[model samples]
Every structure is written in C-alpha cells, then in structure tokens.
Target: MSGLNAPISCDLLVRADAVVTQDAERRVLDDAAVAVRDGVVVEVGGRSGMEARYDPGQRLDLSGKMLLPGLVNAHTHLPMTLLRGFADDLPLMEWLEKHIWPVEFQLTEELLAVGARLGCAELIRTGCTAFLNGYLREYVTGQVVADCGLRAVLGEGFFSFPSPMFPSAEDCWKTVRDLDARFADNPRLRTAITPHAAFTVSPDHLAASFELAVELGVPWQIHLAESPSETAMCLEKYGKRPVELLHDSDLLGGRTTLHHCVDVTPDEIAILAETGTNVVHNPASNFKLCSGVAPVQAMLDAGVTVGLGTDGASSNNQLNMFRDMGLAALAGKVRADDASAMNAQAVLDMATLGSAKCLGWPELGRIEAGFPADIIALDLGSPNLMPVFNHVSHAVYAATGMEVCMTMVAGQVLYLYGNFRTMDIQSLKTEAGEAAKWVLAAAGK
Candidate 1:
C-alpha cells in the first residue's frame, strides 16, 4: 500500500542500548528498537533494521538505558498504601483484627481513591506496569487504574461474614458481576472473583465464587495458607487443610492463583502442580509478618508455577518488585540451604513472565512482536548496576527499584524518570498524607 522507499508508519519507536526481551529465547539485544502500533508491538529488531522499515510518529531514545518488560505485581491490596506502617510490630491476627481491619472498615471512597492514586504512582515509578489487586470497593481502584493507564485485575474481596462494603455474600457477587460488565470492554482493566481467604471465606461461598469466576471467564484468587495459624484454623474448622479444602471445592486450576502458600506441605505443592494452580510468593510480606518462607524451590521443582508479589503496602510497606525479587532470590537460597538455589534469571522470570501467567495474561511480560508494549527502561549507569557482568544477574541481584527511569503500559508512558505523566503526584501525596492522618485518628492507632 506504500511506495518502495516509504517506510510503514507506527505510533511509536522505542530504541534502547540493550533490551532484555524476556521472550521465549530470553534474548538480550544490543541497540534494539521496538516498533509499536495501537499499543501492540509491531516489530522488534536491531535499531537500523526497525528504523528502515517503520516511520515512527513519536520516538523515545534510551541511549544509555536497558529496556525490559515491566514487572508484574501478582498480588496486592492497592488501597492499603494508606495503611502502610500504621499497624506494624504486631502479630498477624492482632494487626488485622485490631488495626488494619478497623481502618479498612472506616475507608471512604475518597480515602480509597487517594490511596489508590498514591499506590499507582509508586507502582509506576517502581516499574510495575501491571498488578493484581484485591480489596473492598475495587471499582474505585478500577477507575483510578483506567485513568492512570496501567493494566490491572481488580476484584472486590468478599468473605462469608458481613463486612462494611457488602452486607451479604449475595451483595458481593452482584458487585463482581457489575464490575465484570462495567470493565468488559476496557483492554487494560479486568475483573476477578476474589474471596478474602481460605480461612475467612466458607467452603460453599468459595465454591460459588469459583463458579462465578468460571462463568465470567475471569481469574479466581485468594489468600491461602498464609500462616500456620491459618492452616490450623482451616483444619480445625473444616477438618481439611487449606489446599485440600480448595481442591474439594474445585477451586484449584490454571485460572486460579493463591497468594502466600507459606505453610503448604509437600503434598500440597504436588496438588498445586497437578491442578496447574499458580502460587504467588510474597517474600517481604511473609518475612515482615513473621510468616514462614514459602517452599518456592519445592514448588518450582514440582513444576508448580510460582510468581512474585509484595502482598500489600500495609504488610510489605512497598510495592517494589525489584526489592521483592532480590529478597525472593536471597530467601530462596537461605531456605534451600544452597548458594545457587533460586538464580537471578529465575527470580526475574517470576516477577515478569511467571507473574503474567498467574494473572492469566500470556501475551504480556515479554518483548516481542504481537505483545503489548508494556515495557520499562532502567538507567544502566547507576552505580550499583555498573560492571554489568550479566543483565539478568544485575537486574535481580544488584538493581533496586530506583533504577527505573521510564515505565510504559500499552504504549503509553505513565512514568518518565521522576515525573508521572498521568496524574498529579504532589496533589495525590498531599491527599494521601491527610488520609493517613484521618486513618490514624479514626482507627485509634
């Protein structure tokens, strides 16, 4: 449709010094260029080859930066950023029952919006272009994510018991249906059916939620076996382990992702592998909350897909995937009693493609033709990243969250260096600070 010398037009061209494709081959290309059209990657090759074929309307030159797929936070409670550091230094139950739940119960839509905006800022700045979020009133978070241009799976968390948002379980199911219908056409927004946890949500409700998720063709996730106490409670209440209960309820499958399997046994790991159910390992949150380490090595060895997450800012205090990756690798080694238990590449994979798998988004977490243009650029000249022996090693072991200079989702640049292009960071920070103060006074913290 064009003359011989006229190059094909594309929406944008992103050229970088080196690109960690994270593709099937995990190729690291030098002087790489990615051509994007309509938020999809049209082509990826050497800079000259791409330039010669495509004429880009806009160009971003990461001359001294390394590009890679943006990290995916497999599990999180986004609005909990307002609860960060508010209820620390206590046991999990006390922290939740006395402090966290009290504040969550008192959260208004305004406060939730403020916290979601602040959390979205942090996620963008830290190179997370996609995340799975579970919370109450997730439509508010969904609206914020839609405005911010981030890819997210938002779910309204429900339990068998009455809560502030939903008086009955039927109310929660209606909310889920409404969310699915509302976001059905939005490419970047998705709805999920989420029960709060195995211990809190009864078996009948859990099975019903799973059926609803299946009916809607969406994801089903829950907090399962997060602590020994939770496993004990599930056993005492249902005479079955958490995983066993879920299996009995027909809740384990490829579309399901369980967060924080810290207390899972070997048999449970096998069950996960056999069912093809995914698991999200929240290393920092587990350690911070004194929950035991997840047997990630065992899970990975058993062929169970494992992903990485920061849980919630309230527990992990930050949604930085780099920090979580470093901890995952280090803690994996410590847990396995081997220096090379979970390698750099493996942990990086967990944060990228592995997490993408957990979110049921197979096309993301990779840089390739036909993939969405969810990518990030890091300043390669950072002091800690210097003397780069290997790109994956540096990314996993040495790189912190601060090295991210640009974060793009669906070909839209949401963050550039220290600037947020989608939202007003200063205004959101002011509102978030005020909301935190209100939480302090209202929750009696």
Candidate 2:
C-alpha cells in the first residue's frame, strides 16, 4: 500500500469504470481512479491503488461511466452562439459579408457576455472544458468564461478597416494590449492576437499584429486559405498564397494556429509541417458554408498537427465536439476515398490532445499525472454506448455530446447529471433570447 506509514491528503478522488488516459501509450485502465490535489492530477491508476495512496476530502463515484480528458474546442466564435441559425444556406463570403457582418454591427458588450455565458454552459454540459475563441468583445467574453469556471484562450478579433467594435486599427491594438495586461496573471484564461483573416486584414496590419503576438508570447491565429476565392485573392493581390503570405510576413511558426485551411495545396502543406504550425479543421462549418473539405488526412500524413473545431455557432449552428468528431472522421474517409482514413481514435485525439496543442496548452489535454484535472465522464450505460467493445471508437463514432453526464475542470465540477454548478443556465437562455431579438431588430433582419 502507498503511504503505508502516513496517509496522503488530496482534494478530490474520482472513481470510474475506466480511465481513458490519452497518454503516450493511450492506456485505458479498468476500475480506475484519479487523485487530485489543488487542481492538479496527483495520481491516476487502479481504484484500489489510489484508495490506498490518498485520503481525499471529497469522493465522486462514476461506476458506469468512462473518464476521459475534457474535450477541447480548438477554435470557435463563442459570442456567435446568439446568432445560431440567424443566417444559413449561404456561402462563406456571402454569409459573412452580407448576413453576419450586418448583424455584428448591432452587437453590444452585454450581448456578447450573455452569448458567452450560454456558450460556456452548452460547452460544459457537452463535456468541453476548454476552448480557443476568436471573436469581438473578447474582454467581456473572457471575463464571462472565467466566471463560468472554464479554461479558454480568448482572442480579440481585429480587422484592417474600422468595425463597430474598433473604430480604427490603433483602437484594436489598444484593446489587445489591455486584454493582455488583464489576463496576464489569470489562471483560467490566456489572450491571443487574432487577425480576422488574410483577405480582410491589410498586409501592414497583419505584420504589426504578428509582431505584437510575438512580443506578448501569445499564439497568432488567422483564417488562412479557408476558401478557393480567398487563396486566389491573395495570389492576385500579393503574388502569393495565404500560407506563403504568412511565411513571408514572419508569421508562420510554431505559435501560429491557422483555421480551416481547406484550400491549401501540397506545397503549403509541406510548409505547414516544416514550420510546425497548428491547424484547426472545422468540417461541419466548411460543409454548411459549401466550402471544400479540408485536406486533413493529407496534412496528418505530412506530420502536421491538425485539430477538430466547431468554427462558430452561426456557421456550425452547434458547439458540440462530439458531432465535430464524427463529421471529421466521415469527411476524411469520403475525401480520401479510403476507409482507413482518419480513424476514430485520431478524431478523438483531435478533439482532445490535438486541440490542446493548437492552444499551446501542453498540460491541459491528457489524463495523466502532473496534468491538470480537466476531465469529463460519459454515460457508458447509455443505449448508444452499450456493448462498449471499444471506448475510443464509441466516443468518436456513436456517442453524442448528450452522453456526457459530468464535466470537471481543474478539480472543480462545473456540470453534473444535467445540472450546471457555476452558471445559471435558465437565466442565460433568457438573456440570450433577448439579446438575439435586439440584434436581429437592430440589423433590420
């Protein structure tokens, strides 16, 4: 027995049927338990072994559930949750320029906060404990996420031209600086410098933004080669593709997280792998917008770190990572014309460890010793998850987000058995409804 002489003290102990540790070996321990102390995972092993090792202040028994690392949403516009289904059946450019931008013009900080709270609740209920969000009003969104007891890499969206949020490029920079300062010491939140996209952000502004990102030591995020037209526009205007433009601007590196990348070529894929740049593939959003399927299989084959993402609620219409995992696997097989392409395990990893890499959060993904106690439990007793021949396969192919019964971040239980512990879900829904109505009316939609 561990601590045979003196008993060890821990904050919490979680016992489950199986602990799916996505570690180097990807071990799934039956009758496993995890010991957490001060928000860190102290031990993960057999239940009996952990029980012998430590005496925990609180105990949670999930006997029929499987414990896994909390799902990580690599990319999203969380405030767009209020705009879900606002505009649909439109192309990317048309959707943004014609429908989305007009509605965003009427957005307020309060609306953003309301939407963020709803998004956080949805994410927690669905087992997502962390996300990388790129959107406007990030100051409000970041605070709301922190208050909701989740982890996030919140990025303030910037554009070369004036928008409702920022009257000028300088104003945008000021907000970025302020956000960086505010979240410098925050444990649950980090700031990123997010340029809207290559086509929308001027070259000068892009360069400056990247410089600022490097200075702040934060990840640089941008939508690159999301569509054929965007790539063509870059080639015509700058005599380079979006990837090449980033490379020339000194923005292609380990700290860059490029969203979509549906229109990239083989050469660009090589560049991405060479630079160790991360990619977030939003299969559902691409399909909804009629954007081409991303070259995920090829990118993976080339050794590029690609993660799955739900782009935004307005485009994806949902914040569920389970749906994204299923779609990613199905889309990769269809795109590659091979049954072996993008296996279930790979898709699950994308939603967890791979997505954590995109956010530069090395300690947030895996359920291992020394890692954060950010984890979720799935109801293996659910009908769809019955006959659990393979937990990982079921997680990616059959299970939906609704199967998530409990979600915990850093030893803090944020959701349990359809109940939220941090935020009031009913109040958030009411606020989101009012905000949506106000925005739609202001936009004359």
Candidate 3:
C-alpha cells in the first residue's frame, strides 16, 4: 500500500441506462458507462467503449436511473439545518429580529458541530456533494467538514455583535485567521472571508474583509441586495446602493462571491459581470422572504458567472438543490413571463457547472472525461419522474429530492441504496436531536 493513507479506495466503475453528462454538448447517452479511478473520471461513453477500457474493482448498476453530475450548493449556512422550520412565515427583518437572531445567540461550539454533522448528512441524503458554508463558529465547521469528507469553503460569520467565540472584531479576525491556517493543507476544504452582509458589518470592517481576502488569496462571500429593505438601509447609511457600496469598497472582483442580487440594477449587474464577480441566486429564500426575484436572465445575458444555492435551512427549510432548481424555474417563469426563462437543462447547469464557477472550482462540476467523478442518479420509476418524455424537463419540473437513489463525489460513493458511506447517520441524528433541544431551551421555548 502507498503511504498516502487515503480514506477509501475508489476504483469504481459506474454504469447507467441513462447518463446525462452536463458537459459542453448537454449530452445524454443511453446504455452508458463511466470509469473512475483515484477520484476522477477517466472514461465516459457507450457501454462497449467502457468495457474496452480499464477494468475496475467495483461497479454500480443504475439501469433504471438517470445519472448526472453531483449537485453543488453555492451558498448556505449548513449548520442551520437543525433550525429548519423553527421559524417561518414572516418578513426578512422581522424574522431575523424575532427568531433567527435570538436562537443564534445561544448556539455553542458543540451545538454547531452537531448541527453541521446533521446538515452534511441531509446534504448527502439529497445528493448534494459540495456546499459553501458560513457560520459564527469556524473551528467547528472546519472539523466537521474534514471528518465528514465533503467539499466546503468555510467562513466564520463576523459582525459587530459579541459572538460566543469572539468578543471583539480583532478577536474575530484572529479566529478566522487561525481557521484558515488550520485548513490550509486540507484538499476537501478551503477558507473564505464572510462579513455576513453590508447592513450587519461596518464599512471599515467590510473594507478590511476585502483587503484580507486579497492578501490571503481567498474569496470574499457576502450577502448583498437580498431585500428592498437592505437596499433602503444601504442608501440611508452609505448614500449608495448595496452593490455600489461593495464596488466602491473595491470588493467586487473575481475573488468576490455575492449571495442574492435580488434587487440589483442593470448598472450594478454590468459592474459585477465586468469585474468577474460571481453571483449565487437563492430563489427559494428570496421568495420566502418576499425579496424580489433577482434579474438572473439579465445577469446571465451580461456574461456573469451565476450559480444556484439553497441559502440556509432556517430560510429555505431544506438544502435540496433539486428543489432550488424547481423554484428557480418557477420564479423565473413567473417573473419574466417566459415559461422557458430558466429551463430544466439550464438549472441543471446552474447546479453543476455554474455553481462550480461561482465557488471558484473550475474542475469539479461536469461529468466529462477528466472531470471529477462526482455524480448522482435519480430513480426514474418514481411517479414524479415517470413517463419521461424530456429528461431535462422532467428533472427540472417533475423530480424531487426523495427520488435521489445515489450520490458520488470525487469518485467515492457517499450514498447508495439509502445508506450513507462516510457519515454516521445515527450518531448525527442523536447528537442533533439533543443539541436542538438545548438550542430550543436556550431560546426559552
């Protein structure tokens, strides 16, 4: 054996009756096969072509499923999965002030870890292979990601409030720096500078975050123009729109990752596209919060690298990218009055290749030859996916998370036959249940 001490041997060859490679051509092959070794796709073609290729130690038969690239969550608060459905049916500001903030105030490091394990499990269960996460707890995120074997860009939420981990802004900076150093060598993890948002962070702090991101060569992820109230607040406080404030602060660039441009203008969209600033659209969260739908078609038309994200469970109530894609198409159709505004194939790309670009990962999205063997297969026999006339349309409009039958990331099978391979589901459930009780108790409910 080699000295690398790898987690698992992924000499896996996965075959399916229907394989839809979300590649340059949007190709889908019937009676297709894929060869994976050492965490990357080596071959993808007809079954005969793959049979002529190098043999594998294992094979997954997915004859009745439609295989595609693993879904990517471009933005989310993973640890908030425990808080799913805890608070709902309110506007953004009131919801934050009355419920989310108060509950967050009592979260402990252990609780965050417990919640992250549960979130990872949920993501795996629903075929989400990679996700970007931001939370008030940093070390916990790093540890859980490393242990759970998921791709993540971890960022500690920083604000003016006295958080549990940091007392001052300096303390928060120091903590994030330490986290960055700790995960510097981890391949499955990376670090980002998250300032929460414009309304929560001071101008000086926002500038510092961008500067630090530049210095450290990490992406800066921020919430911007998420709601009209946020826009109003930015104008009142900084005499400019949220995007303008960010652009003025020199924070809009290739290394900048913005969540929700729900209320941005055409000019701001142009600036973002020109600067190569990546934007992630959370259609579900925006709709739930009554935040106006983002001008996604306009941004895409302007050549912006856009992706899909579920936001967080507290707001989204789920971390399913398929659900997010369905919502995106629904919202896009209603807002643009074009039923084809965001179609199934397009939303599928947004979850795979588009989401990868937003996350600064160029090589981890598609199922093409030489791409990572990150893939998922959904059962087509289900009622939602039955009588498949158009595979793409069926996936975007008819499919649901409950139909996911397999999830593979980095050539490793994370979930199959309804069993998680890497994470301990029972332990996570037990720990998460206890932690949720504590969080609720601390919230005095």
Q: What is the lDDT of candidate 1?
A: 0.91
- Pick out the ten consecutive residues of candidate 1 with the lowest summed lDDT: 436-445
Off by more than 4 A, model 2? 1-3
* Model 1 misplaced regions, further than 4 Å: 2-5
Which ranking of candidates, highest lDDT first? 1, 2, 3
Model 3: per-residue Cα lDDT over 36-87, one tens digit each? 8888887788976676554578888888988888889999998887788888
Per-model TM-score versus the true fold: 0.98, 0.98, 0.94
Cα deviation at 122, candidate 2, in Å, is 0.9
**Candidate 1: tens digits of C-alpha lDDT, residues 1-445:** 9898899999999999889999888999998899999999988899999888888999999888999899999999999999898878777888899889977998999999998998899999999999999999999999999999999999899978899988777789889999888888899998878999987888888888888999999999999999999988988999999999989878899999999999998999999999999999999999999989898988999999998999999899899999999999999998989898999888989999999988988778988899999999999989998877688898898989899999999999999978899999878868977997898799765
Off-target runs (Cα >4 Å) in candidate 3 are 1-10
Lowest lDDT 10-residue stretch of candidate 2: 1-10
* Per-model CA lDDT versus the true structure: 0.91, 0.90, 0.84
**How many pairs collide in each candidate, listed in order?**
0, 0, 0
Query: Mind giving the per-residue lDDT tens digits that candidate 2 earns over 148-222?
Result: 899999899988888888877667888998998887788989988999999889989988988888899998899
* Colliding residue pairs in candidate 2: none
lDDT for residue 27 in candidate 2, whole number 0-100: 93
